[model samples]
Target: MNTIDEALGAVVAAGDLAGAVGLVWRGGAAQVAAVGWRDMEAGLPMHRDSLFRIASMSKPIVSAAAMTMLQERRFALEDPISRVAPEFLAMRVLRDPDGPLDDTTPADRQITFEDLLTHRAGLTQAGFHSGPIDAAHREALGPDLDSPLSPDAWISGLASLPLVGQPGASFTYGRSTDLLGLLLARMEGATLEEVLRHRVFEPLGMSDTGFSVPPDKRHRRAGLYGFDMTGKLKKIDAPPGGVALPERPGDMEFASGGAGLWSTADDYLAFARMFVDPSVKLLSPETLALMTTNRLTDPQRLGAEMFGMPTFGTGSGFGLGVSVVLDPATAQVMRGKGGVGTVGWPGAYGGWWQADPTNGSVAILLMHNMLELEQLTAGYGLGGYGAIMEFHALATA
Candidate 1:
């Protein structure tokens, strides 16, 4: 288990993982290991180029694209998002996050580009709330990964909902990035797919990264996998909570800027390199510095929670689009552990990565570790995370 192959191989052998592709880049070199099956029932092997639904991992790339727009003087961080999409101009806030939607207050201020990037726009996901708000979100937004509504319809639906908190007050992880994506598309007068393809993917050489897989490349895609209640590996189509779909509808016009994007281990490594290596040149040094700097206050960091646990704790902080490690020794594995400036945003589908500037290194693990919310709450399908911890620990060793 000293090497990444042996470490991940053990997880696969133990039935904790179906397959994964792990890569560690350091000292101007890379070490990669592809282990287990892409589809166990079909006996398909995992490869470095096997495509995966990167889920929330899509945030950083979309955030980077927004930053690029900033560099071009397209808009200022302080500008209200309503400037581009006026639907958000007259937004309301819930009196209590879990209270009735009708008990509300006017938003303190309009949401800004910074709010969307930092997830402080007061928007939230259904899972974070317990009352009418959750049901309201599910009815309006449909799924987090792929939505059936057109971009304009989706924006209107989201705007109709009440905010969960005051603008710029705290971190509420939800559809802020999805809104940001649509806003970007509106600004460019193009689809989000076009905007990202032209601005982010093309410039970065991320050919394989996009909202949908073309017919020619479908065979390289990984089949979704999850653990049964008994903790056995099982192939899954649509898991509970609507975090992902077995296959994105061919006609879906909505691109999830937050949780939607298919990519590979090497392709994401290329994107991760931009943060640690200045020579990659995707952003100006000053802009990159601003993007990676911690934006959350002490109270905000302490107050933010995901899955009923303090998200940043005392060891890490939230940046514009990624989590920054303040102290590796105390940072939780969910946020990852590394040097003070290490930054990464893990995806819900078991994808994780980190770029450590102190050591000039990057590590990535891509796998389809989907689990139902019930399974997650019952603690029935967490072996995937353990496998990720092992891969990351050994990859960065």
Candidate 2:
């Protein structure tokens, strides 16, 4: 059997990663292996407490918050969101960039609370679809979800655009969670950050998840890197946003439910723990059940070439915020038993976590820098495969 410590050590020592944090806890025992430096430039060591910008991992958290409100009767899943957000009332569909604008049709149905919760809503962000909407989204919503827009501005920008498809019609990954963030804000009369803190983070005792890295903790923060085709890490300037309920203070203007929460491997494991038991926080077992289900009504069949992912094949579906693997034989994953029941998501950067309730197992894999796309073979691609088998072996051992 390979010592987990050695497995993590080999990844960093080979320069395949700047740093990584891995944690597995179950059956009255716990193991954590964090190797490599948090900041490579200064040769700082990686700590269990080091923070990461867990892009997209933030969605399931926001969905959990909305689910709590759902169980509370704060809103009905079927209720049209236009009741809370009137901007969605006059929705339009895009034909093309220069296609007919005056000729349009209504959404298949009004966007509902459940649609937002399950990511079935007909809203989108820039770059998901190409054409006039792309130009329109950039002009309307500003830059990649990190743009400094007030919640009203963000909502209005999305509302003003045309739907790529109709509400609850299919699976398209974009802005439904941000809409949930907006819905929670309007319902609670608080900012998205405030709602998440009061509703999720503080209750879970995950003290370090936030939207921005502060000046003091900035040193402990991992470098954000962009990778080339060959998998080389190129550090990019750190992006900024308000911290979400930090035990420590930091500020950020953008609160993207799609992507933008900073977390430590430890903090995220605590967040994943909520799935095992939701004793203190926002979601009920039923709502959490709702979250993990295959929520997409019409998911497109994507080839591995589209995402540059070698492990995925032609038969996967999108669940709310995560990729739901439907067929392992077709999916081409390299390790362990992930069946249709396995539900998890990975970040665009290098953060990945998955919980298999079927197995009562959880795994957290964190990386600080981005290298070439092939690096995902190590970062998300290979890391996910390794973690699945490693976790299964750990639990069974």
- Highest lDDT: give the candidate number: 1
List where candidate 2 sits over 4 angstroms from the true fold: 96-103, 228-231, 239-252, 278-282, 297-341, 369-397
Each model's lDDT: 0.89, 0.65
How accurate locally is residue 307 in candidate 2, as Cα lDDT from 0 to 100? 35
Clashing pairs in 2: 97-132, 211-244, 231-372, 241-252, 242-251, 242-252, 377-382
Candidate 1 error regions (>4 Å): none
Error of 1 at 63 (Å): 0.4
Weakest ten-residue segment in model 2 by summed lDDT: 240-249
Q: Residue 75 CA error for candidate 1 (Å)?
A: 0.9
Clashes of each: 0, 7
Pairs of residues at least 3 apart in sequence or in different chains that clash in candidate 1: none
Model 2 backbone overlap count: 7
Tens digits of per-residue lDDT for model 1, 265-329: 98998899998887898899999999989999999999999878888899999888999998888
lDDT of 2 by residue, 9-77 (tens): 766665556777777755435578777777677778888888887777788788777877878889887
Cα displacement (angstroms), candidate 2, residue 116, comes to: 1.8
**What's the distance in Å from true for residue 106, model 2?**
2.7
